[model samples]
Target: MAQLRSVPSRSGRGRTLLAATGLVLVAAFAQAPSTALAAGGPVPAAPAADGPQLSYVVNAVPGAVETRAVARAVRAAGGSVVVAYERIGVTVAHSGAPGFAEAMRAVPGVQSAGATRTAPLRASGTTDIGRPQKVDLKQALGQARQVERARGGTAAGGEPLEPLQWDISAIRADRAAKVDDGSRRVTVAVIDTGVDDTHPDLKANFSARQSASCVGGRADTSPGAWRPWDPASDYHGTHVAGTIAAARNGVGVAGVAPGVKVAALKVSEPGTSMFYAESVVCAFVFAADHGVAVTNNSYYVDPWLFNCRGDAGQRAILDAVGRAARYAERRGVVNVAAAGNSAMDLAAPKLKDTSSPDDSTPVSRTVDPATCWDVPTQLPGTVTVAATGAKGLRSYYSNYGLGRIDVAAPGGDSTQVPDLPAKNGNVLSTMPGGEYAYLAGTSMATPHVAGVVALLRSAHPGASPQEIQWLLKLEADNPGCPASDATCTGTRHVNSHYGYGLVDALDAVRR
Candidate 1:
């Protein structure tokens, strides 16, 4: 199974409520409609610090003059600018000085400034145990031959399609294939660790020119730069890319939109397994600028499970990532994100977060949803996807919340009614080094939705991102919660666990 790293638990007190209250006061003071001060004042010098290097995101009031002023403020605060997303008025920076965020916050035209993480640069104590179990190549080849014989040896691309890919069939992708095989014009950018575009299943559809590495806030667009820096860390992104747009060449397995294009936007660092704000910010802008119609984000912006806007540090992250996403949407990209694997109610009033500040020694703290956000997923216009088992039930580990989840897809649940074919229940897709594997997580569920969006874009070439989103919710299969299930929340048509309902590739393509 594609196991997810469990968050280590630690004990601490709640200061979120107090911090949120303080944020209100700051906002009131900043927005109090004060008279303008006289111009030509001396610019404040950047503050110096005596600490280890840390990453920070600074949000400035939109415009050329305001952005330039904030960029100056970043330098004054002893931070070096890494990238300035001029369109969104957000700048990513690195700092080694103490009180860098506080000093930048005091600058004129700077809306928010905060450290991107609580840990020092390159800190390495956290570990991820989740690894993909490789499938036997000989056995897989034998199964492929058997599937070919069953199809009368006339399957497209000569090789037999993966017969055990029930996850694909469950969403009616095969049925959709009979009508439309997707278009090459549409591209789905996999914004995750990194994709192994050399995998035979992905090579045909992979767009090397559009791919890039955004591991450190800046993008490297050289050929093959978007591939995994370490082959060992390539499993997650390769698997996600396969699910979304693996080629139709009768090789390993087929993708949901096999005819569409796939691009790799490497955002995770080589050793940390963390997707920082700067890298993610670079990814959004890159995708939008490259004509990507959709993006699949299987992981959340790391270091904080919830970035509460009430806190200056967390608010900076929210502003930076939020602006990047909105910019992508404006440029015609639909962003799809996993709701998360924590199984907690995202709509809950108060929840305890013990995995925060994940780059450092994490301490538990209570957070309120109104001020805190599970970014990218909770960001405006994102299609937040929940996971479902083969039995069409919510995946046990999927986080759910009424009005929070936008749609559901087959993510596979190994514990479900075990009679289905490939009873392992985890979603199966291509892995690194020309292998295939079974993994389960809301992470597996997200690409299914992204693929369907690609199908919609392919069918309705002129449709806007908003139009495609509306069509997805309108055509979804409404599998309301079981009448006796207490864990399920909300009404039948639209519920917390199965938002809208299971995403249907056939319905999307037909529309």
Candidate 2:
């Protein structure tokens, strides 16, 4: 999901390896104590029993009357407002009061309210910032030379320096780039860890004004704040950004939509490496307001693995995040999210989750798929994506569901049946510090779809979100189940494993 490094090893047969990182705690009230309407009137009375510092999301009816009433109730319930997304009627708050969640739910205008995590604020936990494995310089260079030679010494107009990125050719993005390298006016926001705008391939197409950091449930628009504080510790976002819009400047690697502008809306917390609901809501709202045409979300919202609507806490999270995503879609932004790395079928009758409340002790629980959701992938109005390997088969770690996934793209499988690239089956892209490395997961695949969306947007500047989505499905190459492949289910028109089939950039661009 958000952290691909936490995905289960291919050899583990779907058993996930938990990331060492813990969830972020609500350090303090996001705003100063004041009788301000936006800050939720005044701080409420402290609870009798002190408990772990917890964050809560309160969804209110979208309007001044309801918002003001909800804010007053939040303050009276001993919760301090972290940030209020007025557009979507979602407010994030933190409290140490034991019954704060229940108290907020009792508010007159509050739609839903619940604690965001099971861990205390500032809880003790280790950080697992995923690092890219160091590639041998000699081997990497040799591969590049070999690819160049095969292509007859660069295929015309400025090809990427690293020519062995088969993932680009797998989707025929290289051919699409030759025809139309997308339009710089169409911007795609990478709403993940953070992007390295300074990378030579990314710097030219980076959208500084549209980029921002939404780490603490609020948007920080300061220049360069959108980048990861520790680039090496968190390289996922940069890599994702590179795949979407790493400029075609004869540099590291070619992107799916190399001519488009890319914006970094950092939502992952640097310390804990967790992406909480508050930060995700903020990122969506920021992108919606900033004219972002598309957003690539490669991670699930933390600390819950599957937010069930039956539970008050999980319901509130789903409402807040879902509302934010819906708002973005209403504003002409097409949101794309990873279907997740767990191989479990999301459409199954029951599934066991052992990764919830990841900041603290996680317990294994059997959950009903209908109620519990892995959002915003499962959320309405968002495009859910599944992952395929180099051989055009489902990635071992990619999650699939009959009706859950909307499309499939190359995420790379190091253990594919017939590995195209012997050294690395994973997709290669520009890493932080002007380097390159291979990474695999649905996280890598989501950007390919987002980049294709960028191309569609560039070609049909007047197209609406619905029209673009229609084209995405219609233009894809429909490859039904491979003989004897258990992962493939449903009819040829639309199926669980491949969705509408592989996303075709060349076909999309030509259409």
Score each candidate by Cα lDDT. Answer: 0.73, 0.76
**Model 2 Cα lDDT, one tens digit per residue, 38-151:** 443444534533766677788888765676676677767776666676667887877778788888888877889887667654422223222345566567667677777765
The candidate maximizing lDDT is 2
| lDDT for residue 430 in candidate 1, whole number 0-100 | 83
In candidate 1 the C-alpha lDDT for residue 291 amounts to 92
Find the candidate with the highest TM-score and give its number.
2
Clashing pairs in 2: 1-299, 2-299
**Which stretches of candidate 1 lie above 4 Å from their native place?**
1-49, 123-130, 143-161, 417-422
Give per-residue CA lDDT, model 1, range 295-400, as digits (tens). 9987777678788988888999999899899989999999998887777788888877877776666678999988888877889899998888878888777788
Error of 2 at 504 (Å): 0.6
Q: What is the clash count of model 1?
A: 4
Lowest-lDDT window of 10 residues in candidate 1?
14-23
